[model samples]
Target: MELEAAAALGKYLGAGIACLALAGAGIGVGNVAASFLNGALRNPAAAKEQTATLFIGLAFAEALGIFGLVVAMLLLFAV
Candidate 1:
């Protein structure tokens, strides 16, 4: 009802919304792994060769999620 209360509510809501980025990151990581496995299944020999690529993709995707989480935490605690 008060202005400060409204602002605080907004901050919490914004932080919650920012967490949605993690969901997108999760989906992206899942897609990357799924595609890699699909290709690996079809080519067993090359699967070994592509393991590094798969992990790199996974790390990149996860990094985005971690960044999103940091943003959410900053919103909740910093601003």
Candidate 2:
């Protein structure tokens, strides 16, 4: 029984740790946006060309957050 409890605790802790990736993703998205804005302000004409790249960066960052959430859920519920 004690071993089972310990395993449960570990699972919960791991899930919590996995959720930190979401925070990293948020930071990444912010950096991407800030960098794009900086570039845009410096060169307005080129901003239109780089818009697609900005969206791609955002999508990748958000995808990482989603992946982290899935890992956390799987750790918590699926073992």
Best by lDDT: 2
Question: Per-candidate TM vs. native?
Answer: 0.85, 0.80
- TM-score of model 1 relative to the true fold? 0.85
* The candidate that achieves the highest TM-score relative to the unseen native structure: 1
- The sequence of per-residue lDDT tens digits that candidate 1 reaches over residues 1-79 is 9998997999889889878889999999999999998999998889988999999999999999999899878878887
Decoy 2 TM-score against native: 0.80
How many backbone clashes does every candidate have? 0, 0
Q: Assess the local accuracy of residue 8 in candidate 1 as a C-alpha lDDT between 0 and 100.
A: 94
